[model samples]
Target: MAALAAPTWRMGTTSLFPRLFSSTQQTRFALPFFPGVTLTIPIGIQLGLPSIPSILEGIWEGILKAVPKKKTSHMKKRHRQMAGKALKDVTSLCKCPACGETKRMHHLCPHCVSSEQLLHSLQRRKAHPADIFSLAPTPNSILSASGSSSLLVHSTTESTFPLIQTIPNAHKLGCHHVCTAKGGLGNVAASVGFGGEIKIWNKSQNKNEWALDWEIPPSGDVWAVALSENEEYLACTTSDGRIQVWDLNAKQVIQTYETGARGGGSFAMSVDLSRDGKFTASGHESGAVYVFNNDAGRMVYSLSGLAKPVRAVAFSPGCKRLAAAGNAGIIALYDMQHGEHVGNLTTPNARPAWITSLDWSDTGDYILSGSLDGKVKVWDVTRGACVATHSETEGALWSVRWLPKNERALGPGMGKGEMFCAAGASRSLTFYREATGI
Candidate 1:
């Protein structure tokens, strides 16, 4: 083999190895020995063999340009998908199969829970053969009044609530109202009869029997009556709308607060004395509610709002608020200090029904109301909402009372547990307890 001569070449601008070698013209290589068989090869091919790194880099750049970079984080991508799914779920609506009512698909049926659990723990018993007019609960007993002349007493301390006694012929005409003081033993009870008379009764210390202690002759027709917590005083509403407070210990009239003569003295329908014995409140047939100051012996505030007859008036346990209800089908709450109407509690789409009775819980956190539609409602005062409702009978309910809180009888979820008794035209006493299981 003969030696071959090297040739210089310029790199072409379009070649991948433009810096490694330059080539613009083609060159030919010649073999020395064979004169007739001289071989020729291009200079660019010879120089390109040593430029493998630049060719590889150009291929990698081409691949990267064809692919895309990830711009979104994994968590951001997942959150966007979830938000879209939730929006779809919220807009979707469905009908409840059981009641054929429209409701949210993923939420519980409110109507079903309210109707089924309202009276879930109720028990009924025939306390009076006739319609029960009033109920008064002591620390250990419940006194009920009916159209019958006798007053029935039931022991509440026992689980069975046995019939303890009956005051036969206590009221020649049926008793319309009955009330007891807060103290259990040695406390007195007062009753107003249809015959326009008031009777005071005391329990026997030795025999534990109730007997007539005294009577207040009928100066006027007494329609309703209430006793102080200490049993030291009694307040009664007369047909002439006169609120008269009597000293039980002295057995004489102490003060008379009169509702001004509207329509010849609006008939006083209901009266209640504060447990603290500081105030007296009366509801009249002319839709008037008057709160009187006992110390000053005068009407302090004449509350207005209900345009229909006022049937029930009660002061809260704290004596800071008063609730009044009647044929208006709504309850008006009043602040005692300023005598201003604070708020009104009304049911949505409620029918026209007379609210006959009202009572406050021991903590004054809730109010219990009985209506002529046979529905009992528990009102949450602070929230201004009706927390529970029960309608077991179509007959009218005349009276409802909250039982004294029994600490020993409390169950789970029964923080200061609650129990109430209701009586009415159903001719049976219905007892309701908090549904702790709920």
Candidate 2:
């Protein structure tokens, strides 16, 4: 490239002007665009920016940037190419001997089989066609709800965990939350749909079928629903932050507790009743957890500490403690009798994920928590430490619950009696048991 003529400073000029770079005075560079093709560029760098004085402005046009050279060597080039090929799984899907989920012919199922807990995957089933939003397990069966307009029931008695019943078209707008009793104790089940519709379901005594029990009228945008231990009373959370207890058998509103002085309040995200039927707890979008006295029909405590939306709250089996977790990703434990923030269980990481669900073991010795990062962690309340963490899937885990400590058959590899099932955006349910106990 040829350089432009120099701008001469006239002998009698009042102000001095810097001379423009001439063709011979310029530094030229050759840039290779392709393998052999090259383009010669004049090195005319501007002396000052636009913010500088006008005297420094008039210079040759500037070539702002140059193309970078290839830095990868022959070894690195072939390593990256082969590494990508190794990462790709086989196109064929075969049933894994360990977890029963279809995977590649020789590769392990990353969703279930892992070295850590091994996560002790027992059985994995495709529970829904869409994302599984909630999981409710009865004594002998597990009920799942998804974005699809149906509910699925799988029996936990056999090793295969077969689908026994499918409630088709159960909800028009899709169900978001489903609950069997407080602790899966009754024949009754309740589900709240995205369209603010609530449906009650009951299992037949003779047949393995689930029939519609009743429907509650939508009041103030009802969302989360929970049934009492006996299934006689149902507690539901409304968007306006009011918790209402309905007499399921009588089909009437029994007790209504207003969270705010006026009427409307924060949106309640989750609700649960104590196993003994003593206290009713609700988690709100404003990070407020309210515990109400069932007998007195009044507020017991407005718990604090969590500064973000609280997603799930669960009462211990003994009714002495309550566990609450949410967007803060830290599990807070409160004394139900005094409502004091006893402790918090946080993951050992820089940024923690939102806790989506929480459930206490039958003995109330351990608390199981599921987070948005698809991790299921069991916490020892006494030590306030995570005993075990299972990362079966990389999708958000919407729900996780202990399988009532039953005689669930061990398919191939054995595991502990205390099994917990996790489900979420993966559109499947993955069950895990304790690895050491088996």
Candidate 3:
């Protein structure tokens, strides 16, 4: 047999127990090891695994660098690099709605409108709402009352929407309520204010701009007003709890209904006449909702059950139900026929948020409400459940209205194409359309 060479170690300690060449020879071999050191690992096999010597060396270097550094400049440079990377990650998520362009989501999109300077300008000029008591919308124009003092005619021509013409000082004193009949004719506009007076405005457009033609003096500051579908009879609710119906053609008070048998003078907040002009609904601050039969000319039902001041009351398009909501954060629905309380709708974690505005879809399929909590919700009338909720701000929402349906395309019940508008303490109006097809 050929002789075999033995392996040799130069410096490091070898295992204490070494294997012998023959079974008869001793197997134990005590190699020199430093004091306090205790390790005996075998070395000889060759397995095909990648060596990671460089990885271990890099990890050791990182550990040494991570310790407290003495220099302030180097630490600041490292932090700035980390912050730059974070900003880059955040800019990736913002996008624009109108053009589908990527932009900071929290910041306004530049392509849509100039928000930078306009926001600051609005802040410098504080809230100066002229106490608009009545606002009636038409296809081409809008009639508004200014605190029982003036009549302002606004043009709905600037956008696809309306713009205010702001006729200054149309009334001798501030007016409480002003409204136009169903169709925009010349002589049907009405205004009432603080003093026991009512004035009618007629637009006689000759060669120049149309101007007010005549004025009528009625009994009180009209707190709320409504008009018949035929535009013949005008109904105005006074602060003293009397709803006076006027003959627009005759220019005289036809009849008056006394509210507040549930203890009057709780200021009628809202009033509306049915589409058929047979029933009139009124909501009072005393939490009382009264429905009267204008055809029979008497009080029909005094709907009860709401405990808080009723701020908003709306009759559905079909005049089948009335929804009233207020400081209680609960919305109560009443059957118009029997004046019986039907059901209530409320948010789950309902804030004691005052209900400010209400509007029903033309089909009576949905009822939209806006509240002090700045939430606009769409309620499914048939199911009596909230279908959609949009909370855009924490400011009070003052007005919510559904745009009249398009008669050319499909009526209210047939298609899903619909639009609504909301405006409030934020000083900006928002328009929303159905996001999906019906």
What's the count of clashing pairs in each model shown?
Answer: 4, 0, 10
What is the descending TM-score order?
A: 2, 1, 3
lDDT of 2 by residue, 29-142 (tens): 344443332333223424542422443443322322344666889999899889857766445466655667675432335555344434222434566888999999888889
Residue by residue across 71-160, what tens digits does model 3's lDDT show?
Answer: 678878889888856644543244455556665433334465446434643442222255444455554455555443545554432223
The residue ranges of model 2 lying beyond 4 angstroms of the native Cα positions read 1-70, 74-124, 412-416, 435-437
Model 3 bad stretches (over 4 Å): 1-134, 144-164, 172-176, 181-188, 194-196, 202-213, 260-266, 390-394, 406-416, 426-430, 434-438
Query: Best by lDDT, which number?
Result: 1
Tens digit of lDDT per residue, candidate 1, span 1-438? 222322222222225455644545544545566443333333453543644577899899999998988699999989988985664444435665446566554333445445433333233366677899999898777889999899998876654466789999989888889999754343589988889889999988788888999999888788899888888989998888788999988988899887876426789999889987889999988898999999999889999988999999999987999999999999999999999999999887657688999999888898999999999888889899887777778999999988886756432222346678889998777766642212
Return the TM-score for candidate 2, rounded to 2 decimals. 0.74
Clashes of 1: 4
Question: What local lDDT score does residue 342 receive in model 1, on the 0 to 100 scale?
Answer: 96
Global fold similarity of model 1 (TM-score): 0.69
